[model samples]
Target: MPVLDKFNMVSQGAAGNLCWACVGWSVARYYDNRAGVPPRWSTLCEYVMKAADFLDGISPESTRCCDGERLLDPDCNQSRILPDAFRVSSNQGSVRERALSFQEIKTEIDAGRPVGVEVESSSAGSRAIAIYGYDDSESQKVMVGDPAPDAPDGALIPYDELCFGYRHSDATWNHSYLTVP
Candidate 1:
C-alpha cells in the first residue's frame, strides 16, 4: 500500500472537465480495486457526475451543465453516492472549514486509499487532487494525482500549504473536499 500507484492516473482532457466529480469517482474506484483500463475521460467524467446526482435531485444527464472549474452548486454530496462497491462518505462538516486532519488523511493513504482534496487553482477555479501518499522526511508533503497536472507523477503540495489551500471562500460553500472511504 506504499504510495499506491495502481490507481488510474488521469488528466482532465477537455476544457469543461469536472475535476471535483472526476476525482470523487477516481478515489472510489481505486478503493474498490477497480483500477483497470478506465473509460474515456469524458465518459468517466459523466459517470462521476451522474453518481453524484442524488444530492440535488437532478437527472444524470443534467450534470452535463456542470462544466465550470468550480464544483456544482451545493457541491456533490459524497454521502449520497452509492458506489458499486465501497460505502462512500465525507467528513461531516461544511465546506468552509477544515474537514479532515492530516492523520486522518494519512491513515487512509496508509490503507492504500486515495483521498480527494480541493485546492485553489491558479488557472481557473479550485481543482481536485487524489492524494496517494505522504512524505514526512525533511519536509512534509503528500504525493497527489492532479488532474490538471502540466506533466507526470502529478505534483506534491506541502502539508501545511495543502491544509491552508483546502480552506476556500467563494460564492459557493467555503470548504469542499471528498474523502476516500
Candidate 2:
C-alpha cells in the first residue's frame, strides 16, 4: 500500500468555521505525495478555503459549514477556480449506500489516494476529515488527518469509532465522502 509522504497535520487555528481544512489538507497531501515534495499546509489551506466558496457559492460563516455535495460536484468549475497544480479527478458517494465502507476506504489508501469523510464532532459539531491509511492488525484502525485545533495529526482511530462518527445521524451531512482517483 502507498503511504502519504511529507504529510503533516495542521491546526485550523482561529478559523473555527473552516472545518474543511481537513479536506484541503488531504487534497494537498495527495498532490504533494504525487509530486514528491514537502507539504505546504498553510498555502493549501488558503486554496481550499477559496475553492470551497467557489464550489459552495457562499463564504463560510461561523454558524455554517461547507456543503459536501458542492465539493464533490463533478461538473463544477474546479478547473477554472483551482490552480492547475491543485486540480484533481475525484469520485464521491453516500455512506448510506456503502460507498464509505472499510473496504472502499482501504482501496483508496492502497491506491495512494486520500478519502474525505463528513462526520459528527462533539467538539465542533459537524466536521470533515481525511482518511489516509488503514491498519488491519488485531486492533483495526484508520489513520486520519484532522484539522480541529485540539486534534492530533495522523491519529490512528479505531475503525468502529470512525464509523460511528461518519454515520452519526446528527451530522450536517451524514452521508457523503469524497475520494481521490
Candidate with top TM-score is 2
lDDT by candidate, in order shown: 0.52, 0.55
lDDT of 2 by residue, 1-181 (tens): 3356545555655455555644655576666667777655435444454555545554644212224422323222232311222332233322342336677777777766676666654654666677778888667688888877778888887777777654353433244454443
Q: Which candidate tops lDDT? A: 2
Cα lDDT of model 1 by residue, 21-107, tens digit: 556556655644543544333444354555555454667665553454434543432322212212222422223244356676677
Clashes of 2: 0
For model 2, the local distance difference test gives 0.55
Q: Compute the lDDT of residue 12 as modeled in candidate 1.
A: 54
lDDT of 2 at 12: 56
TM-score of each: 0.58, 0.62
